[model samples]
Target: MSPPLRNDRQLSELNTPQRNRYFYGKLMDVLHFDLEQEYLIAEQRRGNRLLLGPGVVCGLQVTVIRSGGERGLRVGPGLAIDGWGRRILVPDEFELLPLRLTDEDGVPAPDDDGPLPRQLILSLCYRECRSGFEPALVPDPLCDGPAHSEAGRWVETYALHVHEGTAGDVVRECMPELGELLHKGRIQEALCLLAADCPELPADPCVVLANVAVGPRGALTITDCLPRPVAPTNRMLLQLLICLNERIEECCRHDTVLLKVGAVRLLMGNGPDAVLDSPDERRVIPRGREPLGFEAEFTGAPVDQASVVMDSSVEVLRDRTPVTLPVAWPAPQRLRCAVRNALEPGAYTVTLRGEGPAITSAAQPPDDAEPLDGEAGRQWPSGDGTPGGNFVFSFQVDR
Candidate 1:
């Protein structure tokens, strides 16, 4: 069975110059591309619209000529002749040739046959503002979402009107409720009304509220309700680095701290350290750099002044000032110098006794301390059983 003869009449009727122009115009509207350089040349058979190029149309004009012993298709003779003297008896061997024509010099011919460009139609839909609001700008909802161009125009007009301290009578009359709402604390509500009433109004109420809040003695707290934008913090600073280092080591893996009285075993999971050793232990000092102006006030009677010895080399001012001391004579006080330029970042135990005010012994577990587990962990204690009047240590560097 042979395929049906290919006819050009229907093809030509569908592909016309006028139809091609309209299709390209619609394509331009959809893509939002500049159409100045692009135009459509229709391959038309008659007056009706047909296939437009930059595209292809199949099965235009086809004729099959059967000749003796021609088993396959062949092309010969002139450029106008296709598959000359060949038989296309089988459906698989159907052959058709396309005839294409273009305007002179390969340029798209002018489309003056139809209505103007769709862009012109769009321009007519936009109504002009009144004389008083000569530079009024509003978002075109018909445009792509969040019309940025229209929003920018609104911002400019708003700036001008705000500086002038007057919105024209028409604007004031049309939006009396909005004006009243602006004076009140209802900025968001006012913007909603403005957007509903004026299709071209900008969408951001915060900008409008900011301009209104800047006057002398104006209630600027309204601006606080507006969104508070924030910038990222510097997480790589020295203080944060130290805190994170200790927290990761203490919590990610089990470790034990030793004191004179007993040992504390700490395990890591979520929400700070899990105290596996004792439940009574509470976090007295929060982890972070301590603020200045922290003074130790104790009610107990002060002991006699005594010279103290430190296990680690003490950092003293050039003037040889005492870094650690007992409190003032009448009050039980301990004066410990702030940790300055300390290389090791961990807790240290400073043991104090009546032997003439000295760090009688300072202790920290060895760096290669065993992990807390069966048969491998070592017991360590960090403090005396008495909790009163213990010194807390911290260090930080400014970068």
Candidate 2:
């Protein structure tokens, strides 16, 4: 017996089953796209967690449509990732996604009169159909198709406006403040941030399409039955930081503290070992020397892409008086700043903290928090109201 000539074709259409469990490999005698798709993202009922996206990647513009007697929300085209890393592409067609009027238990949606506010949500779902079972399953001899045709056994993954709610926990882990945002009825913002951060953080299969308050007599669905939203401690600390930073900027106008967001991320992933690379700037300079900068180096692994960035969370002082000096954070590894002009005779100090949690509104810093080198009378709300460790690094200039 001689070997048959090889051609490009999918073996799936050829045989129903060769041997129960053996997954025979193929070559140029061509393999179908199914094999490739399954190789990357297989349909396994049970396995390790698949961090999928229930979040939107972009453009699922939601609009409340009221066409004649019909009133429902329309979900525009968008791309949402699924538990299997599959891109559930929402087609560009207009789809009026009906509202769910009751909870999973068939209870009516809470009205404004109730203490518990109504929370409505939109979720992404996955639907699979065993396609190719139609009358066209058998191709005509004249039809221009593949070299061979397989009858039966085709799966088509569809975006079922309905959600299965099978996303892993890691989806919520990366975006710690997601629940709070959704609770605050800041659905759009939450979705946007989640989409923006998804690529950078980790693979998240859980995507909350949208959320809003339930209006009087508003219909509700089981998916809409989200847990009661509560403000996370860390989120509060971040808010405090924003508020205090605005106040400082508005009041003092001179000294600005830079929020080291990147540093915080690096600290989370790589461990917190950011330290001072250079000794404190303390030297007696000639009275008539040319203007120079006061630069300080900090040892840290390079994380941020920018060569230099401003981290305003620094307090610079020329002797006793406060002065504004833009600190250049090339990264935690090196924090440099040229002296605002020549290093005058006055003592200069650069006080900053490492990747600290969102500072809270505490009369006293946490026991583990490093004491501030600056004046005790002044308080800098630097976190999200959560109690967390603060790594203080105070560089002083003394002659």
Candidate 3:
């Protein structure tokens, strides 16, 4: 038969030997931090459920040797437990050192290195509930006294910041996982976890909407709500989508753009042509006179030689132009030139006159230009010049 479950609170009250040998046993050795370095430990068996908390807390549990000698593992400084139902356990071997490094106003004094007891400084500040044990240790520099104490305090502060930053990053990056928890009907729990782990998130409408949208699917596709036309009115939507996409990409493997783009396209497609004309759409698409030819003038500097290439529908009007050298000493490094092109009703190409570089025209067809479909619309360079930069311009041709 299995041993009876133990309450964490009661376990905390047990003497070092009893807690270590009888309570924890084999379970005590297995606690560890995940890839994020966040602590995870199995503390108590409450009924069939296993309780886990930060490694610092787990380390506080005493360990007893077979000879009955007990040793309490030091709960390293620089660790703190936050969130509801979270508890902190300090080993009987270690005691709290209450030397405040900062002034009463919370500002650091010139002598204030930071928080003391470098190892115990957790990323987050939390309440400490004493188990009514007498203080067994006092705050002192691990090495020498006073002078080194301040330095140690500074080190503690730095370590705490590092720990907190790391935890915050992990929490932010694991949004999808949090969302998954919510999807599994653990909404309140998920939110609580998020709040406890990442309190930096603002309580705003957008955050609420984002949480709801991501919660059920364990993912969020901003493209669904993204406007079709790229305009000022939809700028906020576009920015928000970009930010979300970046966050999702960084934190989880989810690609918001790929998921939502098709849906956005379909939605925009269903709208009337007039809607297409509206500047309020948020999609990333080229607009203007369909496939219209425009001259791109390069004026600031002098170039030894310049060339152009058309990879898309747009064509270069000028076949060749002289490389104008600058007149002054150390003459302007680059030269100004223009690619004038009147493309066929379809996309066309105009290669530059030299061996240097080429620029592709736009993909959009000109207003008066003819329409070419599929491969027929793409303009390729003839086999004369060497390819340097693949500066292929893109444009669209309307029928």
Candidate 4:
């Protein structure tokens, strides 16, 4: 399938509602989106409501909604995302979405002042955020699972409000302190940074603060609980922010780290270690009456032991008829079995699928290891496990 268009005007011209539809269409086309998975996201059970329009900036990627109360939410022009976090950018106008406050019995939920319901309403006005602009640089949840995007990275979030103030001051104040806390792995300290400097917030209207990182299975859902009038009020806003900070910290922290596989490589029968990197390719199997053997190296968070299952198939390139046989994935260093039957095999393709548990490792790096920098940091596991996914490895076969 052809890739989506990358023109700015083509996308930016649409309002938020339209853009969201476009995003959903692209997600279904490119990422294999499923309604079942959407249900799973809603089932994760946390909600957060972020007002995205003029002056609001969010770096964390997820779905955000507006409180359908009387405050009159607006999507500015286009998403005004910038390098500096404090920019007053405007996104296109989005239509108002309805809020649902009903329980499973279709009855109104009790108003006990606990929190808003996170059950997603199909018609609600919300959009899923991505990492990069234009062609969003986020992993497909369908292909890699939601946990894949955050596999081994630390994630921090904050509540941002658009009001009057220079972006520079806010950036200068928050970035340095937050960066220090992140660098030193001081999670608790980082969550408290915003509250510590509460007195320095830009006068009436502007409010922003940082807090703790989310866990591997962590999910955030934003909702509208506070009244519209309380939004613009300073005293009420501060109280709400304090409450939010405490809640976020409590929800995202955990004892065990989550892990996921980063890469996989396939090598055929004791050859010169030629790697089958592409998803599809052509190869030749010997005409001998023997099975084709192959081994794979699964790289990600190195753990003490892992049990892997492989799904494989060999199909004739011309007619695309799959040749059937008993298949097995070998031990860490052993080859199990290969193709047994050899019909009219001029050229064929073999495809392999890999799946396993979200692998974890408690192994620590050597004390004398070099300081992690740039690519090195990425290569070294952050002592976190990765979520598993079905991976494909394909190559052509010929006699």
Candidate 5:
């Protein structure tokens, strides 16, 4: 079962003879890439589908044309890639001639509807070629034509695919399987499906070159659309932020208390406590401190109304002893509380804990699947990268 662009190991060897053929005859291998690489590029191109895979390289502009009392289209030269990652090239411009427009005739067809437009679909096409070859033909003395007319190499002209398409149908042709997975919210499964090669992948690759809408009287309307990016883990981030919201009714609510921590860490001593140093968790100054507490950082979405339940959800400990301090939300998306009791500090450990949603993985990943890029996938059991439940972070109060 050879796939598209089959590897033959022989295209690099020689120029094929006219009358005779060998095992090496049809290979199209170049110096940089052998026939094997030719076939293997298919996989490389396939992997890029979700990552800017297919589109026009340059040219291929479709424009409306008018001649006498008739209307048609003029297509410009350009290159593009099909959905299957195959290259489509056009070397010369050509006009696609059509009959007079429905309204142009001054006599509309019996089935003519309103001024709705007609769509034109353009894509890649394949063709065969033949050219003049070796041995010259024997010519009669009276014959005026060339003597070598009998032998010719095969050649063919291939280009645009013209079809009438429905409105907004051009985007629907891309990666239907991946689309289905996304619509179902199976993001990890979609990633795995792309990572692994399976039989469900499409065999015939066809991509849209352009979508042109022709008005009822033959005016061309081309709609240009761009694709946006999708990240697998963006929505799954484990944000531990807590906020408070006040409501006027059941429908409308506004933030009342948004817990925000620090722009800078507050360590002890007076003199306006000037510590001009690079910011980090390690505290340099020794302290019989005035007051102390550390801020917690979180990501993803913030939860509301945490001011009433802050103490139960957050925990702070020095070694094994707990420091009781009232927690409040001064601003949004930051959690903080100050321990008022002054301490004789030599060495201390403060562990901060906050609750977040579950991570991407719950249990052990499938045993058969090998680690990708030498790292476990998101499907693995929750541990480091996957943060869920309550997250723990500790910083030392220095002496």
Candidate 6:
């Protein structure tokens, strides 16, 4: 009988040539990225792209040990890559240490006057890529389809020469079965093994971080991380697929942009605060008096015909009840409110939720508009980059 099929291979075989041209074209044209790095951070200063690769590059000064599963990994001070920043982070706990020199017997050896040269193999596997953000463009079969394409293949032996730790420092090694499962593109299975292990040793062939390549059909480039399944391991993989698609949508839709509130201001009269002295400071307002004023400013992506909504509420600390605030936008994206009629005496927390129109080009219908047959539904704008976020202020209203 034949051996059972692996997930990676099974997926690759399922690829069809269905085109997702709209999203694919936007990603290709709007963003400039490299097919090598795990994530690309556009550098405003140099106009050059910085590559944030996966795995730690330990040099000849520190020692790294398997810290145990999901708890935290340990590294001696040196140079290390920031997973989110996609850049080199400095010395200390988050830093990468130098590689330990070792002798043939797997003992730590004295470092020679210079850095030692060693050849190491780095294994990598392709995960999955999602399509771009055009609501009109249907999901691409080449990428999101059930089958994987050539991109799913593995780079079993990526060779590199560098100073690294000797075998002795590796208190625990990755499970052989774990590597085998991943080698065959059994991602979920490998994650199960990783989660089951106590001290998570470095899973061989960890996920690649910065490399993303465009497919022949203009789909966004994607490469999967090696199996290091932890709690969010599965979630991380799924999010990557979503990110690849959303990024494209973000590129094309400039009319609808997100608005973010960094802080909230309180003014005595019901008017916009020219300069809020203490944003976080809460003041006492008499129960029977003129309405107190509140203001919030925003900064985010540029947009045209942008309308913003600030949903706010004040909770009476005494009764722990919430009263909605009628906060309105005076100009474009500027939020203000006058609290007069319903001012109860007590400690309160004012929460604000800022929403902007869904991002779409002038050519597309408004998000609230109905969809046409076979056309993508309404597209909503996003906050600068985030869809929406919240801001809160605390103060007391007294008799």
**Best of the candidates, TM-score:** 5
Q: How accurate locally, in lDDT, is each candidate?
A: 0.25, 0.40, 0.26, 0.32, 0.43, 0.36
The deviation in Å at residue 275 for candidate 5 is 16
Candidate RMSDs in order = 30.4, 20.9, 25.0, 29.7, 15.4, 27.7
- CA lDDT for candidate 4: 0.32
The candidate with the higher lDDT, 1 or 6, is: 6
Ordering by TM-score: 5, 2, 6, 4, 3, 1
Worst 10 residues of 5 by lDDT: 368-377
Clashes of 4: 32
Give the candidate order by descending lDDT: 5, 2, 6, 4, 3, 1
Query: In candidate 5, residue 81 scores what lDDT?
Result: 51
Question: 263-366, model 6: which lDDT tens digit per residue?
Answer: 45555554444343343445555655333656655445332223322231222233356655665666654556656644556676655433222222122334
Which ranges of candidate 4 are over 4 A from the true structure?
1-270, 277-291, 301-319, 324-390
lDDT of 4 by residue, 58-109 (tens): 3221233445332222222322221111222233344223222443222334
What is the Cα-based lDDT of residue 377 in candidate 6?
A: 16
Q: How many pairs of residues collide in each model?
A: 17, 42, 44, 32, 18, 33
Of 1 and 2, which scores higher on lDDT?
A: 2
Candidate 5 overall lDDT versus native: 0.43
Name the candidate, 2 or 5, with the larger TM-score value. Answer: 5
Tens digits of per-residue lDDT for model 2, 1-399: 112222112221122322223365744322344444443343321111223322444566666766564446676776655433445566774554344443432233556233323654555554444435434444544542543343345343344232223222222254668888988999998988866732222232334555545456654332222321111234556888999999998887833222221121101112332233323213343344433554433221222223233343455566667666555555444455554454454655544533232221212223323222221111232333222233232333333
Q: After superposition, how far is residue 195 of candidate 4 from its true place, in Å?
A: 30
2 or 4: which has the higher TM-score?
2
TM-score of candidate 5 to 2 decimals: 0.36
Error of 4 at 291 (Å): 7.8
